[model samples]
Target chain A: MSTFIQQLANGVSLGSIYALIALGYTMVFGVLKLINFAHSDVMMVGAYVAFFVATGLNAGPDPSIASALITFLAAMAGAAALGIAIERLVYRPLRSASRLSLLIAAMGMSLLLEYGGQVVFGPQHRRVPDVITDERIVLGDLNLTVHKLIILGVSVVLMLGLHFFVNKTRTGTAMRAVSQNVDAAKLMGVNTDFIIGLTFAIGSALAGAAGLLVAFHQQGDIDPLMGVYPGLKAFVAAVLGGIGSIYGAMLGGLLIGVAETFVAAYLPSSFRDTITFSILILVLLVRPAGLLGKFKPEKV
Target chain B: MRGAAIKLGFLVVLVGAAIGIDFALREIFNPHWLRLIELAGIHVVIAVGLNLINGYCGQFSIGHAGFWAIGAYASGVLLTVAEQKWGTPSAVVEILLLVGGMAIAAILAGAAGLLVGIPSLRLRGDYLAIATLGFGEIIRNVIVNVDAIGGPRGYHGIPVYTNAAWCIIVAALAIWFSRNLVTSSFGRALVAVREDEVAAEAVGINTTRVKVIAFVVSAMMTGAAGALYAHLDGSLDPDTFKFTKSIEFIIMITVGGLGSITGAVFGAIVLTLLPELLREIHPTLSEYRMVIYSALLIVIVLVRPKGLLGNRELSPSAGIAWLRRKFGKGTA
Candidate 1:
């Protein structure tokens, strides 16, 4: 029972990170109908930014709550700027082209960020200093790390904030209107570009937070290739939950995290990736629209 | 009659000049140049095969490298292990063994393609891309875990039989097959599906059949390229056939006009050479190769969305017209 509880905690913490990143993917897909492959790399950029800020300021080698908050804020800002710039420069020009063209461009953007990060940061891994050093809490053989609790707590706060923002704010209403019908939203005089840009910024900031949270949970190590696996997993979560549904992205992320953890723990590590992908393929084959996704016919 | 004679004469001259240049270059340049040419030729085969599925059929498959790895390993295991088991090792027998190995690999990769294509074809666009990407990852993981094929450590000790003559022969065969396939009735159906699947289906075209056929053919050719790659390298590693490698193949297809054979060849040659040239200029540029390549890809798409050739193939008559324009009609 204790082992199960520990696994459940691990799953939720991991799932929280996946859910955060997957929300960005699902939101972009909902609004633009384009799979932004570069979003994953943006998350990578966020982690690197936070790593540099924490290390350069000597905040990490000596753990301090104030420094962590400042670094996290700086990372979020940097990621938001990068996201806005990418949308304006690379993707905005090809907005009128076929989805394939946009997809190719997104991939190009992804490669650029990944390799450019390699060039600037070097290929080696940099460790993030642990700012949270609280002792593990033991409850009758169920030991939970404080870092995991922080990750789960931060993720919940972010998700709730997003929910409130999307459901309550005027811009969120505009975003929903555009996603439901771009032409009708335009007819209603909504500034599509601004909404789109804001969506990317908000989504990218969430990814940035997720990156930092993950860094904390893993003890603050960042590398150029760190984004690829998590990116692919988040994409899988998005697909499994329902590509364009925000709530679905969250659910999918959590389910995939649990599934992956359980599979890895039970099955051989070699078969772990295969099992995860097999589940995706099976899910896709059974429900083309995904688990929580509802199918809407394309506009002819 | 005059036009026909002019076309025939131009073709003859072009073929003669090409052969002359090939022979001259062979004599003047060292073996390294020949090797590069051979490598480019193999990539041409792979890229052209990818073009049929991605460019012509409008399917986004990022798993070509998985099939390539399958073909390489399949052929490598047969040629090396099977030869040892049999113990004959005669030249004719070895030739037959190699051919058999290649055929089997093609068949296996083609079958794998069918398995991936059947379910994926039901969805449109990005979903298909994700499915194919998943398939590639699955293949990589399976290869890494399977101990029989040496797993992640890779396979070695395959006899090297890839040569200039074999590379040229394979390139010619692939080009001819792809060109003929694109111009035939089946090819027209593929283009129709690519343009509008619903419209094609309304017009009685079996979109699924056409897609499956093109996918299988593409896989077979990619497998053949893999066989050649295995022989050239004399070893096969799982790392060589990763998602990035598949993206490289996609890059070749994208830069080359989708439906143009000549574009694939041009893309394969230029991209292959550009990296080598960049490496020679500055060693640090090697690390930034992917960054530069991706940036150039984005810029090219924004600037010329239709690609360099835009569905046009190079022809002897076009070459003669260019020559005549350059020489001003009285050079002879």
Candidate 2:
């Protein structure tokens, strides 16, 4: 039915955002093996930056393509800088510390961003300037919107660009090498710290893009805590797709988005969160390594 | 046998003294301060239980709020039913009902812990954290869906049976249990597992069983604390048992020193009192309280990674040994 098509379209658009956020989580997790709890906060920061930029530019409800591009670019740049700073300041110093210490530090970093955001941005919701018009496009019985198209197009383009960059670029290869074996990568004269920072930068930029799109999609829904649920759900997506796998995170995000949308449509709305989490537990129980993650037997 | 009897007698005296002080303080201090002290004790119970899981067992399970919620709702439902079945009970019967409710809460929470623990047996580090996080959200969702217990709106009018004396007694018991647990051979097994899981399994430690046991015991204690919290507040809100609350408990144990019962107790009391202390100082300061709290956490981890106590118990014998070492041979 047309409703099914509409739902699928909506799910994919949501999934694209989740995929973008999950990329950051997966990439950082790949290099550092830390959960990077603050990554979600970084996404929040990105959304806020875009909000300010668009507002500063006086972009009304229907901004031009140029203005939207500038907004996205500024947000991504700001977020990337933050990511590198977090790595250098908070994480890098604790490189040799215990796992518990690292995790707690990460948590502290997350809280600092969230509460600090409340302090800086105020706790109230800010309606994002409409980057794109919310005009509906009717294709026979299917209902589509400009927001959905923009989300899909931008996400696809970015994902393709990222895929090529990670697969083909020398810097990306060096990044992969560091993730596999830090010492080995260092031995090969790779600047491991720089690569790690670069990983954070790239991952955070993706999250920034995701944040901007989400803000645009859910006009007037931007807030300090907006990233928490999406961040968590995206994390579940990363895990479901087998964390550390780029393609897996993408796959997982889409699957979760579709499943969540379908569940919301069919079941009592309250069960939406429960179902998402249930999938995570089920995946973890069945395949602890995640969908795309390889199982490594522990060495004594 | 004499040593066991002496220890028992000492605990009994300590508890009796606490109860006496609690009553005396009520007559002297304002209700506000008294409530803070009671809440501090409750936090101690939860913190100690969390330490047993995260610190001793080396399993980072952050779904503690789920267990706490379970205990609170269970106690709330029971007390509500009891009040309906038999109007207001006599003083003695009221005490019995509260104790019975706590026991049931602990049992239910412990059972839920077992369910969560089995799934966690296969996970480690961040993965375990995520699964536990998921379980916590699931619990909150389930609570919201159940219409009988007020669901999202939360339960109200639970009997107020919790007090400073009750809180102190339970907190003392929690500390005692954790101390005994960490010092025993089983405790050694847990430490071994924390240090290295594969090595512990190689040395014949049933890692799975140890983890599950830790989860059950920790959940049980937290559940009891939840019951006390319910009775103290006379209400239950599902929102109270969110991931953020679990993070608060984790922060307490981390600040106090993981795997140290005394550290957990110390951390719990200090943290519970901190917000109140800030509020007393100034409203603006309290507004930025969480920021300060988080910064302190980072600084502590950066400075003393093992936490303040660093897996060391704070006891008289240890204090004496420390004093002797510090002051050369003459101090003893």
Q: Any runs in candidate 2 off by more than 4 Å, and if so which?
A: B1-15, B329-332
Tell me the whole-model lDDT of each prediction, alpha carbons only. 0.84, 0.89
- What shift in Å separates residue A178 of candidate 1 from its native position after superposition? 1.7
What are the per-residue Cα lDDT tens digits for candidate 1 across B82-190?
A: 7678775777676677678778889989998888888878676576688888888998898899888889999888887766655666777788789989999999999
lDDT of 1 by residue, A89-189 (tens): 98899989877788888888998898888888899998876655656888788787888888899899999999999999998999999888888999999
lDDT of 2: 0.89
- The true-versus-predicted C-alpha distance at residue B23 of model 2, in Å, is 1.2
Structural similarity to truth (TM-score) of each candidate: 0.93, 0.97
Residue-level lDDT tens digits of model 2 in B1-332: 99999989988898788879888979987999899899999999999999988988878877899999999999989998899889988989988999999999999999998888888775666666888899899999999999999999999998899889889988988888888888899899989989999889999999888888988999999999999999997988889998889989999999999888889999999999888888889978888988988898898989998889999888899998888798877744
Where in model 1 is the C-alpha error above 4 Å?
A: B1-34, B321-332
Provide the clashing-pair count of each candidate structure: 1, 1
Residue pairs whose backbone atoms clash in candidate 1: A128-A220
Candidate 1, residue B48: CA error in Å? 0.4
Residue B217, candidate 1: C-alpha displacement in angstroms: 1.6
Candidate 2 structure, TM-score to reference: 0.97
